[model samples]
Target: MARQKDAFYFDGFRRSADYACQAAKLLSEVMHDFNPDQLRERMDGMHALEKAADGVRHAMMDELVTAFITPFDREDIDELGRVLDDVTDSIEGVLNRMYYDNVTDM
Candidate 1:
């Protein structure tokens, strides 16, 4: 039972990482087709993906904190969750900076 729970938690972390990667891909595509008019829409899509990733990360963290017998160190699980969230945040920061800087070219 503990192994199964650990697997489930790991799976959730993997899914969140996947979502962050997908969001980064979408941002890359948008950057390739840079246009001020479409920036908001593109950013919106990226934000949605980031939110989804964050949701999964938060769920994992909550489970880790609540579980009396986590398969791994609780701190490690929390750190991994934070890293997954930071991936999206880093991407978002780049996009936001570009938008604010008035960068019209890719």
Candidate 2:
């Protein structure tokens, strides 16, 4: 049981990292190819990635509440997840600012 719970946490951590990577790539693509016509669509895509990352973090929190065998302390695991989520948010934030501010250049 403990081992299984640990596996869940590990899987959650991995997924979070994957989301961060995807967010970074998306942000890069949007910035590299700035297009006013596609700004809305790009923002939508970034929002989706951010939302998905949030879900992963939320799941980690839910599991942490009941997890007895986390890789480290429960608070540490929770903080790690939050930090990972923040990374996605920070990446997404750039695109969001561009979209909202009507950035027309790199």
Candidate 3:
């Protein structure tokens, strides 16, 4: 049998998940090596990652809006994307709090 291509946009969802994992990892590293002095620089890096992830989600959504047939339910796909974005946002929130509080010790 010939291999079938992924009809659903599962790869996009997977990519978003991967981004969330990376953001979480970065958050852990920042906390482990907490350096108030470098907080701004570290945040810049995190923002870049977040922005890239957002780009992926947006592109997916744009495609989804015009897709006639999707692999999964549209609601589920949208929710998945939103949740992934939330994870990244939450991690950034924690880092933001730490930075604002001048948390020097992990």
Candidate 4:
């Protein structure tokens, strides 16, 4: 069946938040384990989550560029997207530091 476009207003933002949650959850998993032996493997998995989040952010931006009427101010939406991206990036950064510094213990 045909769908309605305006039926969903904050879908992009919701998806971005979902991505942030996923990244945070994975970060928690890696921190809890603190397994240096499998650090590379865990980082690889984190990279996948980061990339998926990036994809969602990029798609949202592209949609924003062509949207006629957003639920809120466009700048606000953009800023929110950036902030959420930073959150996921920061979570990934923690993993990166742990892997780089050989920190295996809590």
Please list the C-alpha lDDT of all candidates, in the order they appear.
0.83, 0.86, 0.82, 0.80
Model 3: runs farther than 4 Å from truth?
1-8
- Model 1 C-alpha lDDT per residue in residues 1-106, reported as the tens digit of each score: 4577788688988897898788788878877877888888887888888888888887897888778888888888888889888998888878878878887777
The TM-score of predicted model 3 comes to 0.88
lDDT of 4 by residue, 1-106 (tens): 2235433436766777787898889888877876788889988988888888788788878877898877678898789888888888888898899889888688
Q: What TM-score fits each model?
A: 0.90, 0.92, 0.88, 0.86
Model 2 agreement with the true structure over 11-84: per-residue lDDT tens digits? 88899999999999988887788788998898898899999999989988988887656678887898889899
Query: Residue 65 deviation, candidate 1, in Å?
Result: 1.3
Better of 3 and 4 by lDDT: 3
Scored by lDDT, the top model is: 2
Model 2 steric clash total: 0
On TM-score, the stronger of 3 and 4 is 3
> Which residue pairs in model 4 clash with each other?
none
**Clash totals, every prediction:** 0, 0, 0, 0
For model 3, residues 46-98, the per-residue Cα lDDT tens digits are: 88889888988998888789977777688988998889988988888888888
* Candidate 4 Cα deviation (angstroms), residue 51: 0.7
